[model samples]
Target: MVSVLTKIFGLTNIEIAEDIVHDVLLKALESWKLKGVPENPSAWLMAAAKNKTLDFLRHKKQEEKYARQITPLLQSEYTIGHTLNNYFSENEIKDDQLRMMFVCCHDSINEESQIALILKTLCGFSVSEIAKAFLTNDSTINKRLYRAKEKLRELEIKFEIPVPSEIEKRIDQVLKALYLLFNEGYSSTEGESFIREELAAEALRLCLILSQHTAGNIPKTLALLALMYFHGARFNARIDDEGNILLLKEQNRKLWDNEMIQEGIILLNMASTGDLVSTYHIEAAIAYEHCIAKSYNDTNWKNLLNYYQVLITLTKSPVAELNSAIVISEIDGPDAALNVIFKIELADELKNYYLLPATKGDLYFRKSDMIKAKYFYDIAETLTSSPFEKKLLRKKSNMCT
Candidate 1:
């Protein structure tokens, strides 16, 4: 609704569009209490918005730009109803939202602010919720959003889809934001729940929209979606009824969503057709290998190691190198993996990363060096803030006794 209204209002009055939507919702809350909710609630809301728009036009001051812009469309009741109906339709809503996402991810805005704006506007996320997702304070998120909105206003960016020539560059920003959102859901940094499936679900929903559009249904997008689906397939088994984290080795494969895994495979196959082999393609292939493995011991460690090598070459990310070492532990033994681990820690950015310590703990435990295992786990316990992770580290540390 905000997207549609912003489209009609010419981007200058986004705040006003949001205000009108709020007023409409408030009216619904007040009236529905006495009227006991209308049967055609959607139609009622559209009608209300239409009437509210007309009312604003009628009482507008001389310099109201939106009033002037929409006045020509409100010459009669029929035109007003038609225009509102057109905007309120399902297809229009989806298109408006897609375009709104592109606008939110405009190059003028920084990546953090772009994701922040997408959460707030397109995903109906509260400022506090977005702050929690980002592991930051509400005031910081608010300031970021304020700056992003001001930038959009200052630039007067169009509220439409990008041209074909610009789609490749523009779409990556959107994909990055969505990937971060899914990762947050898969492993929440600062929440009671280890997995916020709702956030993951929302991200998947938005990605599917991109994967279906002509400008967006490219190989990279398919690979990203495949990665999301492959992870999501195991969501049910990733946590116990008591909300305890279930390591992949311990999760019940019977509980995994086979349908989703199959869909992910189909997407992965589709992704292979294009010339580009993005990091997402490698990640998705690795995830697909895990999804197809019958058990933890049956996993193709060599295949995953190869993908991680490619990933490291492409990204040079310490995180990727750390993960690659884990696969090496499975294939080559703890000593070889530890050598790689030592090399990875030379990078300054990963000095305090808990996973490095945790990986070292696992390798020491595998080598039956309980004292060194406990030592690394102790460091890991201090490095991580997650309650689930702390508990897991304590369990590992206790094994040394």
Candidate 2:
């Protein structure tokens, strides 16, 4: 809808388009409450948005100016009350959304602006939701989106997709935005819950959309999709009925979605067949190995350790090193893993990162050093914002107390 609306009204008119869509949604809720959902709900929504757009143009006295272009656009039978699904086939929607993502995440926009635009235009996130995702105030997020849209409007940037020659350079930024979306859903750095499946589902939906677009469907794209799928398959089983996080090792394998796992394996194979052996592909490979293991004891920790070792080389990030340390703790021993984890010079990025302390707490717990373990857990308990995380840390604190 963002794509189609932006194409019609131009990026400059996105705010107006959004308001119209919101009004349509409000009408839908009121109408559906009494009338029930129509047979073709999507078509109904599209027609409503179109009608709203027309109303806006007429109200503003722009109908006469836009008549030549608008008349034919509306007359097309497919543009009428046709099945909206027909307009948004997997391939077409993929291309449109990928183009939209690249546009929103363009290098011209800073990361703050890029993410705000994605949350607003693509993911249907409210200001509060985006603010919570970033662990910032809602006013801060609202200002960011307002400033971002103002920037786009002020620059008079084209709403259309970039040409083929320019796509290669822009794809990385697009992928980065998608990755952020998934990470927010998976960990939820600040929220009541540890995970938000709505956000995760939207991220996976966008990635799958990317994989179907010819311009975006590189091997790396397939790898990212496969990675998301493999991890997502266990999303439900990752939490208990009580809303506590069930660590991956303790999750019930029987509840895992086998079909998603199969699809992930297929996509991983396809990604490998292509020339892209990106870090994501390797990570998916690691996760795939984990999922295939029948039980925690059956895990191939040695292979995962090897994968993390290489990942530390490929991405040279502190988090990767931290992850490698965790894997080595499993394979070699906490003592050895401690040597590795403590040796890394990760202060610039990780000093305030809660996971650093939480991970250290786990290692210390395993070593039966309850005093140090509680201290690290205390640090994590303070740093993390999720209520679920606090509960988990308090549980650990209780164990030591």
Candidate 3:
């Protein structure tokens, strides 16, 4: 809704569009509470939004500024309804959303700001939710959003898909933001719940939309979508009835979504058609290894380690190195994994990352070094804000006693 309205209002008047959306939603809440939800709730909302937009445009036709390209059409009565009807059409709304994705990921904005804008405008993430996702405060998120909007306005960023020549580069930026969004949902940093299924689902939905478009139907896009499906397929078995985190070794393979796994496999095969081997391809391969295994012990750790090594080389991410160390432990020994962890520790790249200490604790526990394991578990507990993680770390610490 915001995207469609932004197309009509222009980037400079984004707040106006936002206000209109909020009002429409508030009105829905009130009406629904009194009269019950309409049979076609989605159509109802879209109709309400269209009516509100028309009312706003008609009232401010002569005074308020709108998109320069369509200003004259909006001002004239005969063209106003037709123009709006065209924008509100199903195909145009989808196009507006895709355009909004590109606009949020404009090269002029920094990556962080791009992501913040995407979360707020495109994904319907609240300021507080975005703050929690970023492990920051609402004030900081607000500032990032403010600056991002100002940049969009100053540059007069068009709400249109990039041309063919620039589409790949622009799509890369959007993919990066979506990747982070999915990760946050898959292993959320917020509250007690480790998974925010809705956020991850939203990311996947947007990725699917991108995949349907000619400009975004590239190998990298398909690879990322495949990765998401592989990960999402495990959601049911990732936690216990008590809402505690379940390690892969403890999860029930029977609970996994086989249908989703099949979809991921299909997408992965499609992704492999092109010569470009993105980091997502490697990551998805690693995930696919785990999905195909009958049990944790049956996993092909060597294959996963190879994929992780490739992933680490491509991205040089400390997180990937840490994950690769875990795979090494499965193939080699705890001591081997510890050696890699020690090297990562020396670099101090993951100094404040709770997972670093958490991984160390797990390694020491496997070695039966209770004292060191407990020590690392204690540090890991202190570093993480998630109550679930803290509880799990404490559980490990108690085992040491």
Candidate 4:
């Protein structure tokens, strides 16, 4: 809706388009209450929006620049040959939508504002949720959004789908935002849950859209898609029937989506044809190795460690170091893992990050240091946000005690 409206009326009228869409939503909410809900609610909403836009344009012919764009588009778009169904075809709308996304993520906007606009406009994120994701105040986020849209209006940038030459450069920004969103969803830094599948689901959907486009099969793109699918395939098994957290080893692998895994593997193979390697490329490779292991015990720990090394080399993060500690415990022993952990005393970043303590607990537990393990587990329980993760930590704490 935003895509079509923005294309027709221009970015200056985005607020007007939003108002029309919001009005239709209000009507739907009211109508659904009385008329018992329409069979094709989306189609009904689109029709209402089209009518409203036409009406609005009719009244303000002289005042609107979109008055000119709407005539030809409306004629061609609304004709019997074209139809609403053709307008809304997944590929057609999506192609325009992604071009809009690239324009939204333009370098002119600061990274914070770019992300905010993309979330609110493209991804349908609420202001409050996006504010929460960044651990910032709502007013601050709102200001950024306001400033961003104002810039777009002032610049008069046409929403466009880029040509083949520009797709890779533009898509990098889009992919970055998607990754950040997926990470927030995958393992929320602020949320109580270890993972919020909703955020991950949206990211996966956007990435799938990216994958299906002409640029989709690019090696890096395929690798990222493969990585997301592999991780997504495990969502169901990661939690128990009651939604309690389940450790990877304890998870029922049978519940993992075999189709997604196979697809991921195929994409990974495709990605290997290219020489350029990104942090995501390395991380995805590591994830692929884990997915290939038939069981936890059957995992090629040595090869897994090698991938981790590659990941750390490409992107040396504290979290990567902590992750390597776990692999060391698996391959060599707790003594080896403890040496790795003790060498790094990261400051306040891990204060609220549950995985830090959770990893510590695992190493201590393996070393027969029950006292230290219990303390770490207790800390992990406090650090964790998800109901599932907290419960899992408490379970570990009880066993440790």
Best by lDDT: 3
How many pairs of residues in model 2 come into backbone collision? Answer: 0
Q: 36 in model 3: Cα distance from truth in Å?
A: 1.3
Write out the backbone clash pairs for model 4: 192-385, 192-386, 193-386
When sorted by lDDT, best at the front, the candidate numbers are: 3, 1, 2, 4
Please provide, for model 2 over 78-192, each residue's C-alpha lDDT reduced to its tens digit, 9 standing for 90 to 100: 5533333434454545555666787788777888778778878887677888777677889998888888888787877766557789877787788777777787787663563
List model 3 lDDT by residue over 149-225, tens digit each: 99998998888999999897889989998898788789774642432787788889889989888888898999999
Tell me the tens digit of each residue's lDDT in model 4 across 129-241: 77877777889989999999988978877788667887778778877877877777776535434325667887788787777777655778778888898888887787777
Check candidate 3 and list the clashing pairs. none
Error of 1 at 150 (Å): 0.6
RMSD of 3: 1.9
TM-score of each: 0.92, 0.89, 0.94, 0.85
Indicate whether candidate 1 or candidate 4 has the larger TM-score. 1
lDDT tens readout by residue for model 1, 48-142: 87678667655663455655656466545557667766877878878888898899989899988988888777776778888777678999999
Error of 3 at 129 (Å): 4.0
Error of 2 at 134 (Å): 3.9
